[model samples]
Target: MSFDYDLFVIGGGSGGVRAARVAAQAGARVALAEESRYGGTCVIRGCVPKKLMVFASEYPGAMADAQAYGWTVHAGGFDWSAFHGKLEAELDRLEGVYRGILSGNNVTTFDARATLADAHTIELSTGERLSARHVLVAAGGHPVRPDIPGAELGIVSDDIFKLDALPRSILIVGGGYIACEFACILNGLGVQVTQYYRGAQILRGFDGEARGLVADEMIRSGVDLHLGTNVLGMARAEGGVRVTPTHGEEKVFGAVMFATGRVPNTAGMGLEAAGVELGRNGEIVVDDYSQSTVPSIYAIGDVTDRVNLTPVAIREGMAFVETVIKGNPTPVDHALIPTAIFTQPEMGTVGLSEEEARDQEPVEVYAASFKPMQQSFAGRDDRVLMKLIVSRETRKVLGCHIVAPGAGEMIQLAGIAVKMGATKEDFDHTVAVHPTMSEEIVTMSAPVRTG
Candidate 1:
């Protein structure tokens, strides 16, 4: 078949960009289209910017720690204008790099939205039609506000990156990592943060102990977290927003933000019209190799609604390229993927949660929670948690969960051991790193409880 390109990729997010770049480098003619920014969610509005905010928010506490450690430190108020400018500049640089990667690999780029016109064709927002032997969709996803009265007056996570200034006080809605992370971030930035979750607890699917510690730390750090509560409605007030909680009196705040949830960005993309099967959530359904119902069409990343992380998407993209272009027929592995949530105390987990592990088979849990040397010396009441879930029969470590300052960094190395099927005996055999919080992971010889 005579086609304009061998591959036509829709969406310039991490997955789509990686696929396009690699396929083009492998000597296949490829083209990609992005409606908005090149770096997509992660670099533009998500992990990248949010991490920077996390860093910014920690300085206040760091300065206090410095004073306690005998170093004279004085910190001033946060200047949102200055930080926001630098953040935008960094995003611009990253977008340029993504564009460079695609163009450098000889993958044609279009700064317009692309949709499936047919099994082997794409229609761009610019009224241009292109045909390809194969098409890949990786449009990512977007945060959605619930259907509530005055919901329009509230902002989503994306709007956080574009704010002119940080509010003096803000109400964050939702109980997921996004809600908890932002609540901590804003609280650290000296905002009077109030968070409301309809659920009994925040971070519902994570390790219960880990999330419990996080919630406690959040409350200690001055976040007015309200459990079993929700915003019945919101309206504009003289100062900012007037929120009426389901169980509390109405209150006014500088702003209200909803971190509710995200949906796949598949609407109006012409996927269903082109015979692509979609889930009830509007995500494109794909086989193990990311091939859609239509032979020539494929979807990956958030649009597939499978493991919606950037690294996972990149892995899926590489697998797609291997299967279609290299004829290797690789399937992306979705199991045992490590994840980190940047909450106040932070959380790093891999394998299974305590609840999940217990449900499967006989398991033993070894956990330790204590005030770390660093925070203890700094006169901070913060504590760290290290937990390991072991299979009773095989003695293999089923999961590793850490809740502390460097939990994210620690989990990466621990994840390797768990991924390699390291046993509890193997961890106990290793020498502990003294004067470190992570040493607890290796030193715990006996299970705290077995079930």
Candidate 2:
């Protein structure tokens, strides 16, 4: 109605909503705009819903383990339609909670898409112009569809959540985390899964050993991995799709999924009209403090292409509010941000990888791979892989990498110490809690750090 707020936030995703609510709580008049659901990508389509499906897909594997634990699964079935319905229902519930949280904090919510009119003003698609002292853009990201003859025949990550039924067979394209996670999920659920990644290894940025272990594990789970491969085209076939590979043979499957990567949702936002600077990748260019080239405008989250994780965006939003609104200067440190892979035998790592750490300084790598003690009794073949990268001279633990069950939970605590510059001796001297998988971090006998 009026262009009089202290702060106007565009894109009510994880970052936008957080900034709006916090700024409003500090007595700033804040208005937030979202064209879609309130919870943004993570809560609606990206993280929450995807993770629920990952958990659901793990049940088939868990049932196999049940026999080892003296439990019988006489008869079982996976109802794809039921699972899809439940996921959608849960997302709807979360979207409402997100809206309530913002509203409860006195942040006004507008159900409209916003386009920049100028540095200090935005005009919604409905012709409502809103002006404010500061504007924060957190529109999030969208999956990319690589240009191919029959690209339209395949599905992107976003469409998978809306599928009415899971396919009996799936051919996944791309080698990034999304593709790998989906491969594991579908394969574990008893789908014939095939992954086509362009790189020689699936996760090119991770350590060679870690990537190798992940590939091994995926193969063990019956995933057909095609590395250093390219998808040439796709075509509708009899009851399925025919996918042609660039350097290989053609394959047919019931479904084709492309998990290439995500790009910023900055297009059509009228950013050019306001002279906002964008990077070559179409990401909003922001300074260390999250301020855009136009000082009055700011950007955060996947929109900026700087560490696309949801938590990183939340912290960046808070940093911007504290520094710009509250007069408390806070600069976010991007280093050592922990990330996790939800695939079977998940990966969790903080700080540098062994390769990256070695590049900066002389390093020693301490690693362990062992079948879990539970497996010794249950007769399960799962194993855990852990690694610690330390400076050869200083003996400071620079990185921690893990591939195992509960790796995500375990690395979070270790991330704090690593962030604080913990040394190898610190991990060694700390008394470990015995008879727990977690204690392995502190109690591993004989220092593995090498000179």
**Which numbered prediction scores highest in TM-score against the true structure?**
1
Candidate 1 Cα outliers beyond 4 Å, as residue runs? none
lDDT of 2 at 266: 95
Candidate 2 residue lDDT tens string, 1-451: 4448888999888999999989988999999999998889899878898788889888877776777788977746888888888888999998999999998998988999998989899898888887998999999999988999899899998888888878889999998889998899888777899999898898888877787898898998799998888898899998699999987698789999999988999998988679999998899999899989998899999999999999999999999899888989888779889889888878888888887887899888888887877665778777778788888788888989888877888889899999999998899899888766667777665546554
Q: Please list the residue runs of candidate 2 whose C-alpha ends up more than 4 Å from where it truly belongs after superposition.
A: 1-3, 445-451
Q: For model 1, how does the per-residue alpha-carbon lDDT over 108-131 read when each residue is reduced to its tens digit?
A: 999998988789888888999999
As for candidate 2, its clashing pairs are none
Q: Give all TM-scores, in the order shown.
A: 0.99, 0.97
Local error of candidate 2 at residue 434 (angstroms)? 2.9
